[model samples]
Target chain A: EAGVTQFPSHSVIEKGQTVTLRCDPISGHDNLYWYRRVMGKEIKFLLHFVKESKQDESGMPNNRFLAERTGGTYSTLKVQPAELEDSGVYFCASSQDKQGRGNTIYFGEGSWLTVV
Target chain B: AQSVTQLDSQVPVFEEAPVELRCNYSSSVSVYLFWYVQYPNQGLQLLLKYLSGSTLVKGINGFEAEFNKSQTSFHLRKPSVHISDTAEYFCAVSENPSGTYKYIFGTGTRLKVLA
Candidate 1:
């Protein structure tokens, strides 16, 4: 099966500009997640969606960041007026099962964003 | 709340030598442990996980991790390392796998395999 895939593998934008990263998860996977990792930092959870609805987004850094899962097949993470701190690697992942005890999550290659 | 700690920021080992990366966690409730690896220009991939059942879990690429509940630790180990094994490894933990939950990740340890 094809794993999670992300677009615009690398992007560089000026500060205060906007950028949107997209992710297409593995087919039939309902649990889609977004995570980010600043340079030299651990990969941190950003949000999660179960189909079309967001299950939890507590990990979201701030209001400037918005995530949408239209039709629940894919997801997009937009950063408005991006800041330098926003420059990092954004990872998208998906899990086939959420009700089970041990579900494996597959990840994308990640979209590297550099805000100057 | 849950937190993970990876004491070593980087580890260097010769190819074909044994290697171990340590991971520790703290949580009020029971936790599910995981190890993920990222090769150059690649996304994070699952190395191994510890939920229930046996304390020792083996994963892809001949990687293994032992979960010690008492120590609150899950350390990744390999009998022999390859040059391709060089990458960044992350340790993460979730308070509960079922229902709504988020994972807490460590600072990560970069393994550098020498030839």
Candidate 2:
């Protein structure tokens, strides 16, 4: 099976600019998640999408960030008017279902966004 | 809500030597724990996990973790380290079962194995 894949592995933009990260999950997976890791920090959860509907987005940093899963095939995370604090490596993950106890969530290589 | 703590930010060990990476978690309710390894410029891969039953879980690449409920710790250990083992290891915790797969990750421990 193909693992999670992301586009534009690395990006650089100035402050107040906008950037969008894309994640294509593994085939047949229904659960998608977004995570970010700032400098010298742990990986923090951003949100989750079960199919096309967002199941949980409590981890979103602020309103400047938005996530969409159009048609439930792939997902996009957009950060508008980006700040320097928004610079980090964004990771995307996906799982098959929620029935099994030890379900595995595969992750992508991550997109590194640098806001100057 | 839950939190994971990786006490050691970095550890260096020689090949054929035993190594241990410490991890502790805090949570009011029951939780599922996991250990993920990430190579340089790569994604995170599941190393091992502790759900129930066996407190000692053996993962891929000759790595194992022992879950201590009393101490709320899941320490990863390797009897003999290898140069290939150099990577960043992250400990994570998730509440609920498979339905709520949201994970809280630790600061991560960077393990460097020397020849």
Q: Report per-candidate DockQ.
A: 0.78, 0.86
Clash total of candidate 1: 0
Give, for candidate 2 chain B, the lowest lDDT window spanning 10 residues: B93-102
CAPRI-wise, candidate 1 is medium
**Model 2 lDDT per residue over A32-111, tens place:** 99999998899999999999999999999999999999999999999998999999999999998856637668899999
lDDT of 2 at B95: 77
Q: What is the overall TM-score of model 2 with all chains considered together?
A: 0.97
Off by over 4 Å in 2: none
The lDDT, on a scale of 0 to 1, for candidate 1 is 0.91
lDDT of 1 by residue, B5-85 (tens): 999999999999999999999888888889999999899888988888999999999999999989989999999999999
Candidate 1 stretches greater than 4 Å from native: A98-101
What is candidate 2's CA lDDT for residue A13? 98
Task: Write the residue-wise lDDT of candidate 1 on A2-107 in tens digits.
Answer: 9999998999999999999999999999999999999988889999999989999988999999999999899999999899999999999988865673767889
Give model 1's share of reference contacts: 0.83
Point to the candidate with the largest lDDT.
2
Which structure among the candidates has the greatest DockQ?
2
